[model samples]
Each structure stands twice: as structure tokens, then as C-alpha cells.
Target: MAAVKGCQFSASLSGSCYVMRPRLHRFSVKVPFFDGPLRSRLVSLCCHNPNPDSFIVDQTVPLSKNPTHLPDDCPQASASSPSSAIDFLTLCHRLKTTKRKGWINHGIKGPESIADHMYRMALMALIAGDLPGVNRERCIKIAIVHDIAEAIVGDITPSDGVPKAEKSRLEQAALNEMCEILGGGIRAEELKELWEEYENNSSLEANLVKDFDKVEMILQALEYETEHGKVLDEFYLSTAGKIQTEIGKSWAAEIHARRSSRLKNKLN
Candidate 1:
């Protein structure tokens, strides 16, 4: 056996044979007993013990023609290939171009796009104070994905004359299409789950993100009112008493106080 070290061996037993090649760190055994056109199979054996007498087979890996090649079905290998990633990002360009219909309807010049709204909501989630039973990171993720479907649906608003159920259906279908565009791997599945969670208000993070959505809207409204010198009373009225979380209520109150002070200053 010592003389056979670092050498190949071929032996026939019961009409079957194996070829063994020994190496320093690993070795491979080729067996040719299969009953198909595939005449030989390679089994890789990892060498753990330094001493040959105490050699132990640590792992056995079956290899195809190329030893380092991964199968086509490997998840990590196929997840978000470059082409698919580019395609998905190209589809998302609409989010950056499509302005929020609410702002556009108000005749505001150069309104924020759907991506701008979601980005501010994400920032709101990021800067929010810690709350018990709330996952801040998940809140950020939820905020980012909350309006992602608008990339396809183009930010459908109540004034669009579409029913609530119909709007939801359109958004859901758009999200599914977006996921498919991303090639449907772990990340795609996660995006779908987060979007659904926000849509259904299924968790504390979802609740907090929902509040951030309203808070972001009202905050934007206040900024628009100050910038455009137009009192957006309807925006404030719609969000009044609708904030769910304590943080959201406090933020909304502060915005309202600031708006009131601005109005008084204008009067004087």
C-alpha cells in the first residue's frame, strides 16, 4: 500500500473495477460499473489526516466532466444573472419618470416622482425612533417596497376613478410582473412577501411603515404649501386623525403646528 501511494490502482472484483488516484489533500476514485452510456463516475475523497495509515474519507463529492462545475439548477449560481438584473432595473425606470398623480393633479410644477415618494418614506422609516415590537430594518424595507408596484401601475390615486379593489388588483399584478422580470429567486420572493405584508398591514413593521407613508405625504404637502404659497388644506384634512402610531401622530402634530405658524406669519 505504501508503494501504491501517489499512484493509480485498477482492480477487478465481481465484474466491476475501480481506479484510485491518491494525492496530498484529496484523491478521486473512478468506478465503471454503471449500466448506461455513462461508463465511468468520479468520486472525490477529501483527506483530513496527515498520516496515510489514519487516512479518513472526510467527504465524497460526485463530479461531472469538470470537477469545479456547478449544476445548472444551483440557486446561488442562477440567482439574478446580470442580464436579468439589467432587464429588471430597466423596467423600474418608470418609477423614476412617473410623477405622483396627486401632485400633478394639483398643477404643481415638476412634482416628485413615485421613486422620490418611496425614497422619502424609506428615509422616514430609517430616522424614526425605536418602538417596542417593531423591526426598524423591516420597516425600511417595507417602505421601499410599499409603492414599488407603482412602477408598473403608475401611481393610481383615488381621483383616477378606479375602485379600491380594482386598484389593489392592478398593483398586485404589477408586482408579480416585476418579480418575474427579476427572474424569481430568493430576492424576488422576498420582495413579493414584503409588498404583500405592507398591502395587508400584516405586522407591526407594516403598521409603522403605513404610518410613515401618511407622514411622508403630509410632510411633502406641507413643504409644497410653503414652497408654492398655496394652502393645501385638503391634504391636511385627509390625513387628520388617521395616523396610527404614536411617532406618526407626534410628527403629524409638529407638521400641523409648523403650517399654522407659517399661516399666521403670512397674515402679519
Candidate 2:
């Protein structure tokens, strides 16, 4: 199957249908990069659009008509419910806006988009939970919902050094806005409590999830550095000291040592 802006398509010898596309294009580890396609220029092979509205799916993938492509597990979106129209996953699927006139994004590019980042982070929290103790499911739920507000507010990198008071204000407002999607009440309260727990690092789970957050960044930088060069190591180092938990600290050291050894290997 060939990939255009996002969709992939293939039809078989016996009239079989295949629609698997590379949904994870964002996870590139290659360099010598080139420009991504312009949205208007994408071509859909064997796909027809006599009128712009004829095709429901965006040129991008997950290839379902609904934006999020309602997982087989997700309740089928009712045609009547307009709120279900929002496609969080597809929005996340689109690559970050390029910051400059180059291949990579500057402001919020490498950092995973809100939904994408949260999904992986949640999975990591669940999978990499501190054994014999912390509540992985609770931590995962927190990580998942933690940054849903970011879609509206945009990524606020920790390094921006925004004042804690201002940041908290912005975050609270963002959360309030998102809770509106579900009509906040006791249900929203539970999610907000989890967010607070994470923000305050009040629980072992929260602290662990926080570590996963940093770990994800470190891993991303390492991939970038791998494709680019050792020059990217500085990015990793900058956040290393900020990690609070022992696990995060240990992981940072391992990443550092590995980076150093890789550099040495290249030199040799």
C-alpha cells in the first residue's frame, strides 16, 4: 500500500481489501530528512472525490470516517451526537507544525501531541509501574487525562519556566474547559483529583507517572540524537537533573552512560 498525506490503500488479487497505513509516521528515527507533504497536494490512489464532501475520512490515516476512528472497542458513534465528531486521535496523528522552514518542528514538535503523548504515557505507567505496590491503572488513567487540556492550550513545556502560579492558573482553566465536554460533576471531580495528584506528586503512582513523563522525553531526545548526532545529548542533560524520583534518576544515568558510550563507539 502506498501512503499519501496519511491514508494507505491496497486491493488484492482475489478482490480482497487492505487498509493498513503507517499511522506511526511520527515515530521516525531517520535523518537526512525531507519535507512532509502539503495537505492540499496529497493524492488518494483508487480513492475518488468528485466533490470534496464525498469522502468522509481526512487525507490522513486511522482511515476511519469518524475522526478518532472509534476503536472496535469504543461504542459506535451515533450519527446524531455531534459531540462525538471530535477526532482527538487524528488531531494527534497530524505532525506538529514545523517551527521554522525546516524538517523538524520547533515549539511543540518533538514533544508528542497531547493525546498521543498521554496514550503512550498511560501505557508506560501501566506497564512500567513500580512493582509490588503503586496502582498502575490509576496512574494510567491520570496520565491519559492529564494533558487532554493541552489540545486547547497548546503544549507548555516545563522549560518555558512559566511561573508556577500562572501555570497552575492556566492548567486549572484548561481542565475546567475540558470537563465541559463531559459535563463536569463527580465524574470530572475524579479525573481532576487524579490530575492534582499528579501535579502535586502526592502519591507513589503520581511520582512514578511523572518519571515516565520525563523518561518519554529522554527517549525521544535519544532517538533524535541518534538520527541527528551527539549534539542532541544536551537536551537530555538539561532535563536529567529535574527528575525527582529515584527511578527517574537512575534511568537518567543509564541514558547518559549509554549516550556517552554510543558517542565513543562512533568515534572509535
**Top lDDT: which candidate number?**
1
**C-alpha TM-score for every candidate:** 0.72, 0.57
Q: Write the per-residue lDDT of candidate 2 for residues 1-268, one digit (tens) a residue.
A: 3443443443231211122223222221111111233111122233332222323332332312222233222222213233422443334333243121111343324544455556667777766636667777888888876665565556665556788778777978877765565444334556578878888888888878888787776776666667666366456766756887676777778887887888889899
Pairs that collide in candidate 1 are: none
RMSD of each: 9.7, 18.4
lDDT of 1: 0.74
Model 2 root mean square deviation, Cα atoms: 18.4
- lDDT of residue 223 for candidate 2: 60
Task: Give lDDT per model, in order.
Answer: 0.74, 0.54
Candidate 1: where are CA atoms >4 Å away?
1-78
The local lDDT score (0 to 100) that residue 63 gets in candidate 1 is 34
